[model samples]
Target chain A: MRVFAALVRQGMKVMLAYQWENYMGLVGNFAFLLLFSALWSALLRGDPEAQARMLSYVFIGQLLQNWTFTPTWELAGRFRMGDVALELAKPLSLPVRVLGDFLGRNIVRVLRALPAFAAVGFLMGIRLPDWPQFGFFLLSAGLAWVINASLYVGITLISLWTTYFDQAHQILDFLEGVFSGFYVPLWYMPPALAAIATYTPFPGMFFTPAAIFSGGLQGAEALSALAVQALWAGGSLLILYGIWLGGVRKMTVMGG
Target chain B: MLHALRCYLLLVGAQARAQMQYRFNFFAQVFSMIATYMGQFIALSWLTDRFGSISGWKLEEVILFYALAILAWGFAVSLFFHLVSFEDQIREGLFDRALVRPLNPFVQLLAGQSPIAGTGQLVFSIAAFLWATGRAGVVWTPLKLLYLLGVAVGSALILGAALVTVSALGFFTRRTYTFYWSLVFPARQLVHYPLNIYSQVVQWLLTVGLPFAFINYYPAHVLLDRAADLPWPLLAYLTPLVGVVAFAAAYGLWCLGLRSYVGAGS
Candidate 1:
């Protein structure tokens, strides 16, 4: 825990150094949210029946999409530079190290997202529920972080086998863009497509939690969604551990 | 020029052979790319079903635009893969090696690295193009076929030029990929719907300013017998010409950027 804390501190320092870039990214995120709001405002102008639901879903979806997509560039670079071995040599376990780094980065993201979210809500007239719902939002967000971190670590392990990890990253981006309802609403999808998405782990990272925040899912359904998310997190961790072991065993450190 | 062409072809061939050496990985990449594209196709299909059309264009017309855009994007990705990393290369002093080479620096830089994975996108786009065109019921004349080929090539050049221009900014600002993303994200949206749906300012920005419309929308509008709002129909026919100008400008800017490049290290 101490080691993880230290690593997180280090991550925070690195993040702070890029404060300007993070500010720019925050503004960009807000801009995109505004763009979506404008498009949807144009879309639902005459259709008051679906307006609230659509706005809520779009806002939450954007939040989840922005938050859950992991930046694997640093991990990929570390692997390529053979620094991942040094990380493994540390006292901290692999998952802990990965989670610590991601958690630290996401802490910076959360801070950055706060102002952006406020600006978006102000501009788009989006209002959130009170503290109780916000608590559930926090819980679901924590799960999202875990899921994202696990997937990043798992995907980065593929670097050991192939140098073309960028292709994998692109594929992951496309999948998240689609399955996580980034561009389009999942409800608008064909029943078969939506059914497949429900079975996949992609939605648990973004759509399920987003639905909760947007009030699309509630009561027993929300609990069931959380349960599925827990299962995914556990499954991902297990798969990551397996991959890390195999990757370490097969590791060939080249070109120091 | 012939030697340059031959060398480039040989380099691409070698890249393909190298990729084939890892057959399992190659197949996995292909399958994954196909799956990724399937998601986009499904989304677009759903949107068409709900909205029927965007602006004045039908679903098939929109699909045709998407097909052309993807085809051009695939070509750029395959051919100019190295150009995409030009910023990184400059930042890391990789350009110095290219500068020392006997061949033209642009050729050397372009042919140095290849993306074998992009062949999957290229093949997929071709399939999508054929399917969309067949369904659109457009009669293909020889002239129209020539125009289509020209549009594809022009689109690739325009996109490549845009990439190069963004990459050239690395010489001035080491961290320019963020700006690149801003440009690319918006440009990606242009390939999906007709420019008329956007505000007049955006239409002007996409057409006269960025000139991306010449790559597909303008030529496509003419090809489909749609009424073009541009003053001169000859402008629509000048897709390849527009590409040449853009590429030349980008090349000139690249040279200027190279002059400013402070090579990172030995």
Candidate 2:
């Protein structure tokens, strides 16, 4: 726990060093938000209510983007550079450190996004979620992060096989983004594609939580979403454990 | 001139050959690139499916505009994507190696990298273009075909100029990535959708401020025979002209920036 806390502190310090870049990233994020909001407004020209709901959906998705935007490319690069050999010699758990660092960075991102969220909420007239819904949203979001992280850990483990893990990451990253409804709400997706997305672990990462927060999924439906997320969370963690065991042996074969 | 062209060809060929060495990795990247872009297109289609036309532009028409932007950007980035790394080269004194060389630094930079991944984008865009054309039902006359060809070339040139101009500005500001992330990338992304959907101010910004609209929106409008819908109808015919002027300006800026280079750590 101390090691994880230290790692989180280290991540925050590193992110703080590049504060300007994060602000620039915020600007870029806002640009997309503006662009998409405009599109939705144009599409739902006559229906203000639906437009506002869709806007809220887009806003939540964009806010949670940093959480879902994992790039195992860094891990791949580390393996290629043999930096992982040194990392493996450490006493702490690799996956725990990865999660800690991600959490620390995300804490900063969420803090940075708060003002924008409030400002946009005022402008778009988005209502705050009720206490229970907010609780459900947080719970689902926590599970989503675990599933997402485990998915990335699984992706990073591909470094054990070949140096082309980055290429694989690029493909899976896009697939995850699309399948998870990061850009478009799953309810808005075609019936067929939405059905297909249900089979993937991605929707639990972004769509489920976003829907809960936006009040799109309520009560029983929201609970079902949480159940699905919890199932994915358990399944992905188990798969990650199995893969880590095998990947560690492969890592030793390569040197570390 | 002939000798320079020959050297450029040889260098580009060598780069391509070197990239093809990892056949499996190359194929995987290409396939992923295709899937990535195709997924974006699918998302757009689903949205249009749910809600009808966007600002009077049908799904097919929007797809046509999208394909044009993708093709132009694919052409530009495939050729000049390496320029994004110009800052590192300048900071690390690698620009000195180019300066000491007999060849033009611009040509050397162009030939230094391969663009196989962009080929996937190109393939997807072309396929989408065909699909859109069939559905949009545009009567392609010989003159229109010539105009389309001109537009494609011009759009590619404008995007390529945008890239070169940004990288050239790296000479003045060491951190061009910030400018790129905040400005260039966002502006470029907006072009993927129709400019008509945006507010007047945004349309003007995309049109005059950045000229990204000329890459696809105007050309698509003209080709779709919706010229009267444009604020200034004549703007539809200005893409090729805009491309030439932008490319000329970019070249001038590149020359000026090259002269400004005083070596790393200066």
Candidate 3:
């Protein structure tokens, strides 16, 4: 717990250092939200239900989505600099530290996005979620973040095989953004595609949480969504752990 | 100018050769880029698939706009990708060295290479443009063909200039990624859909304030033979003019930034 707390603190410090960048990024985020919201307003046309509900979905979606933005680690650069060998020799567990660091970093990023959320809420006129809906949103969001962060960390562990791991991050972030419904509401997605995404971890990554907030999923349906998120969160971490072990063994073989 | 062009070619040749050394990583990056746009296009296809049209503009028309913007942006970024790290380049003294080099700094910097990821994006944009054109069933007359060519050239120039101006900010702000995206992306994205779909105020912002409308929307309007809501119907034909003026303005700004660099010595 202390180590996690320290990692969180470290993440907050780095985030604070680039406070101006965060502000600028949020401004960009709002501009995009406004553009999309207006377009959605037109697309929804006379459908009051979709107009009202999807606005919340789009508004809150990116904020929850960024909680797991990847490329949080520079493991390959560390390896090149001999830092990774030292890190591996350390008494601490690298995965746990990496997870803690990532959790801390994302917490700072999400907190910084609060102002954008408020602006989107006000301008787009998002319905205020009830207390129970808000609770599920938070829980689902936490699970989603775990899944996303672990996937990214696992991808970075490819440093165990190659000299670098990059250019891949852009594609990953793009695919994740689309699949998780940050760019568009999953409800509007082709039914078959949306169903497939539900079984994968991608829906839990953003759609489930935002859908709950928008009241698109409720009662038994909402509980099922939460279960999916929980299963994905644990399942992805265990799989990532297995991948990391394989990567570490390969690194040892190469004496890297 | 010809000499500069030759020098640029030589620099880019060296860059391409070095990039080719990592053939596998290069191909992997290109594949990643293809996936990136495939994902985006899928999202777009899903939206248009769900709703027949967004704000009365059909999916084919929207795809045309989207493809044009992607092509222009792909060209601009490929031309000025090192500028993506304007601050880092300045801090690392690469910008200073560019200044010292006999060759024009912008040309050299423009010649500086990006990863192979960009090639796939440009290819994808071209494919999308062709597909949209075929699906839309627009009559491609000779004059319209010429007009489309002009539009392509004009958009590339304007976007490339925008990138240069954004990069020049490293001289003053010393941090640009945030500010650059705020200015660049919103306007760039606005073009992906018809400007008419947005509110009048948003349209005014794009047209008068930022002038991004001239990049893709106006040319698209001309190509599609759609009349503008704005008073002057001739404005749609002026995209090339807008492009030339924007490039001139941005080029002048770069000179000013260069002067500042000498005075400030950062």
Candidate 4:
């Protein structure tokens, strides 16, 4: 716990040092939000009620996205630079440490994201979840983070087999966005694609929390969704554990 | 002009050679880029499925706009994408080094890096263009073919002008990544859809303010013969002209910005 806390603090320090990059990321979030909002408004034909519903859906989805953003390239980069030796030398578990760093960066992200989210939400007149729904959202969001981090750790561990995983990572990143409802809501997705998404772990990563926050799912439906998210979170972590162990064993550190 | 083209080829060729050494990396890059852009197109197609068209532009028609926009921007980016990192060039005093050289600093900055990353977008755009042409029901005449060639050149210049303009602004404010995101990129996004779907203000901005519409929308409009419906249908034929004027103005801004640059002195 102490080591994890220290690692978290270290991550925060590193992120804060490059605070301008974070600000730029927020700007990118705003750009995509604007594009999507314009797109949805055009599609919905300026129907205020429908538009407001979509605004909240997109806003909460984007806010949660920025808040829980992970460095998908971190492990790939470290492996490429042959720093895995140093990384493994530490007594603590690597995935745990990575999770700690993710948490640390997210704390700053959430802080930076909230005021912007609030201001935009207000101006856009977006719907907000009620107190009970907000509680469910926070819980579901935590599970989403676990699922996302686990998937990232697993995906980036492909660096063990190959020196460069940039292309692979990029493909997976796009797929993650598509499947997780970061690009389009699951409700709007074609039946075939949505069916495939149900079997993938990605829906737990973004859609569940966003759906909960936007009040798209409630009561029994929301509870069932949470259960599904928990299943995915646990399943991915278990799979990630095996991959991490095998990948680390296969990893050969070459000297400079 | 001949000397400048030779220097541009030499520098860009060197970077291309380096990138080719990693054969797996290059193929994977192109493959994934195709997949990413294809995914976006598929998403759009899915939306069209649900909504039955965006603003009365059918899927095939929108594909014309998308392919043209991407192709123009792809050509421009394949040449000037490195300018996206112009902030780093200035901050690291690389601009100072370029200034000391006898060659044009604009060409130097442009040719200083690899463009292999854009090959995927170019590949996808061309493929999409070929596919869209048949379904779009446009009778390709000899004149229309010539105009299409002209559109590629003109639209690329317009997109390049936008890139150079934003990069030139970096000389004034070194931390201008946010500026690119806030202004240039979103504008790029807007061109993918039919301009009519957007508000009149957005249409005017794309047509006149920044003139990004020349990169795709106006040319597509003219080719599709939707000109009769528009107030200034003639603007559809003015893309190549718009490109020359916009790029010249952007170049003027770049020169002005260059005069203001003091080295980072790091």
The model with the greatest DockQ is 3
Per-prediction DockQ scores? 0.33, 0.64, 0.65, 0.47
* Fnat: each model in turn: 0.18, 0.67, 0.73, 0.45
lDDT (10s digit) by residue, model 4, range A1-256:
8888988888787777877777777777876677677778888875776676677778887788766788867667777778888888888878888888888888788787788888998898876789999999999999998888887777788787775567777787778867888767788898888978966888888888988888788999899889989999999898778878998788777962
Q: Is the docking of candidate 2 incorrect, acceptable, medium or high quality?
A: medium
- By lDDT, rank the candidates, best first: 4, 2, 3, 1
TM match of model 4 to true structure: 0.90
lDDT per residue for candidate 4 within B10-101, as digits (tens), equals 99899899989988888888888888788778777778778878888888888888899889877887887777778988888877888888
Per-residue lDDT of model 1, residues B1-266, tens digit only: 98887887787678778878988878777777777676677677777777677665677887887777788878877777556566678777777887787777777767765557577778888898888788877779998999888988888898888877877776777756665565564566555566665667766777777888776778777668763665666777888988888988988997898788788762
Q: After superposition, how far is residue A111 of candidate 3 from its true place, in Å?
A: 2.8
lDDT of 3 by residue, B116-152 (tens): 4368778888898888878877778999989877877
lDDT of 2 by residue, B1-266 (tens): 78788888899888889999988877877788888888789888887778768888889998998898988878886787777778888888887888789999888877778865478878888899989988999889998999998998899889888888878888887656766777778888788888877888999988887899999999987788888987789999999999999988988998898888777766
Candidate 3: deviation at residue A253, Å?
10
What range of 10 consecutive residues in model 1 chain B has the weakest lDDT sum?
Answer: B182-191
**TM-score of candidate 3 to 2 decimals:** 0.93
lDDT of each: 0.72, 0.82, 0.76, 0.82
Show model 1 residue runs off by greater than 4 Å. A20-45, A160-174, A249-256, B1-24, B115-117, B228-235
Ranking by DockQ: 3, 2, 4, 1
Give candidate 2 misplaced runs (Cα > 4 Å): A252-256, B1-4, B176-181, B259-266
| Interface root-mean-square deviation (Å) of every model | 3.2, 1.5, 1.8, 2.3
Q: In model 3 chain B, which range of ten residues has the least summed lDDT?
A: B257-266
Model 3's chain B yields a TM-score of 0.91
